[model samples]
Target: MPVDQIPIGTFSRITHLSQKALRLYDERGLLVPAARDICTGYRYYTFAQVERGIRIRHLLWLGFGLSEVEAILEARERGDAGTIREHFARRLAETEREIGRLHAIAEVLRTQDPLNGGFRMSITEPVIKDIPATRALSRRERGVYQEAIPRMIGEICAYVYPADGRQPAAKVTGPIMFICHDEEYRETDADIEVALPIAGSVNLDGTAIGVVTLPAGRFASVLHTGPYPGVGKAYERLFAYMNEHRLVPAGPSRELYLNDPAEVPEDELLTEVQFPVEDLPLSP
Candidate 1:
């Protein structure tokens, strides 16, 4: 209540925080008391400390860690405007990323309807075309019924598109897809390629793996958009489509990369979902 000091309980009240939380903050060096009585050893916070406590509470609400909050507060105390500005910029970037993820979630929810469900599967006859033997700067991973594969594909795309001077072409084409090297989990080694159709040999550091001639055939293809978990649902729809049409997939289902991770909105990622297959013969 006084200018020089206030009771811990009063400080907690002014800061709108629980005593337990206040104590934790103090222990974490987030908000230390201004003084303590020698005999009673009771914590006392200066009136100014109340304002700092309130600031800490607000920073915590913004998802800053105690250390981050302390650093920001220290910068303020030192009148270091540049450090404050940098912290805010970093916070803004983090906030934007969080918003992007939430927006992707919202988009998936909106597209869950049958009319525009997450996947569009269609069957077509085999056709032949000449595709340039292109080099892909890829990163491979084990996808076996795991969500990590999708992220690996994205990281690969991000690495290639921006770092390799291939981003411009990435804007024109489709959603990214995965190329499965084996059947299901039997061949546990899943090598996913983030392919960009380049004109010539691009100096890439990772293993080239091998060339896959995507044979043109009667295939059931689906377009999967959005992030990892959402793509799983799309794969489900593809399987359902095959079941409904009595189609038997002839070869390993492969994903065709159509968007650069660095440039495309992850929600709107374009992937050509291709499955080599043959229609089940009509029963006599």
Candidate 2:
């Protein structure tokens, strides 16, 4: 055979694809032979087919089945660049999201501080501010930490409006840290509430629950990026900052979720960690 011409066997050898797979590709119109021998019905591949064969093999290595590879290659052949671009873009977005979720889970696993091996004091600065009173058509439940939040958020959205529409104006509270106000039991029994904060004159159940007056108080706030489990470290950092500045929390720490978990990237979660503070330097 000429250097420019390659037999199917030669192509298969070079591409590390089985001859059977090459035949399947040809049958599927994925990679057809450049020329066919009239006398023997043999298929002769060109040097160009070698590249396509290699690409098929590569896609297979990446865990794409033959059918998906054919769809992608066919899109390219039809000169539909948009379809190909969209395919890769969607894959990229999915991979990024998976990576973010993995990071978040890992952070959750490694949350225990090696030095202390227990919860310790965390504090921050004092800044006077106002948090408007709001009501939530809220639901409370006790369940697994990871699963409870997302489901409740969904329920709140459902109660407010259509699930298919854009999210209504709202704020998610943190202090996501839950405690047993009644008793200390296993982690499973912890009281968890997902509150949706909304503006004035809100009717959750056609009447006011009560005006939750968020007192005007000083607070030290920090931005925590990534998933909830990763927040322990950020909280630790905040505690260090507070202690270094000689500040004490005047009230319970408040977590204001700045990003929605449903849409925001897991690793890029924006959580504002606000600790009510008493001793903060007065601005000049």
Candidate 3:
């Protein structure tokens, strides 16, 4: 062994990086060892690599992905603070979003916890009816359906009921309407529009808030009672009804919240699932 060469064990201990991690970095060429025994294939590091090993540890501790850490190290080598700053900024934004998502999850667990007994779902027979036109203040966004629904609901309500003691711009007429504009189910990046039915006129005051008129349509609607997680079963039943009746969905599906989730327990929450449908053509 060379006098200056440090064995993998000593290197791992000195840098506080595991031998497994050191091997990964070597394979990734992020922190390759100084030398290796040709016959035994054992990795050896030098004192010069101690600084880089510590840097890698620090970067990993800071939550940088392996690839991002490599980029950061390369940027640092070229004195490219801008690149480092960009990575930092992007990571900062992602961390903020994750924090918000966690907060939302906590709120759900506190208010609408359905995990106690796995909220039992009860669905009623589907009914075909004509839906009337109504005015609503809506927020349409693209995101994960589950996470975005509650967050956007709060966002829209905040505007109507400002924190400061100010008069509400519009009167809430009915439960919120959640419309999914996608033909297929999506875990993320699905188009979601949440509309709050309002009777009184709303003064937008040049804001981005949208006032939409829900067009009249024929829809197959069903009543679902239980937690939102089990609401998919209700959807399945509704679609089965449509299939039996030879009806095809003509537009996006919607869910009208029949009860305030904040006030009701998850097992007792009510939601009306509706899907616009049209009759199939007769065979010639």
Structural similarity to truth (TM-score) of each candidate = 0.52, 0.43, 0.75
Q: Report the C-alpha displacement of residue 70, candidate 2, in angstroms.
A: 54
lDDT of each: 0.63, 0.63, 0.87
TM-score of 3: 0.75
Which lDDT tens digits does candidate 2 get at residues 53-139? 898898778656787788788897899899877777756665665676687556555564455332222323433354444344445
Runs off by more than 4 Å, candidate 1: 1-3, 38-40, 114-133, 137-195, 201-229, 234-270, 273-284
Residue lDDT tens for model 3, 185-205? 887789999999898778887
Worst 10 residues of 3 by lDDT: 110-119
Supply candidate 3's per-residue lDDT for 133.
88
Clashes of each: 7, 2, 0
Clashing pairs in 2: 127-218, 127-219
Q: How far does residue 152 in candidate 3 sit from its true spot (Å)?
A: 0.8
Candidate 2, which ten residues in sequence have the lowest lDDT sum?
Answer: 174-183
* TM-score of structure candidate 1: 0.52
Whole-model lDDT for model 1 versus the true structure?
0.63
Candidate 1's displacement at residue 185, Å, is 16
- The candidate, 1 or 2, that scores higher on TM-score is 1
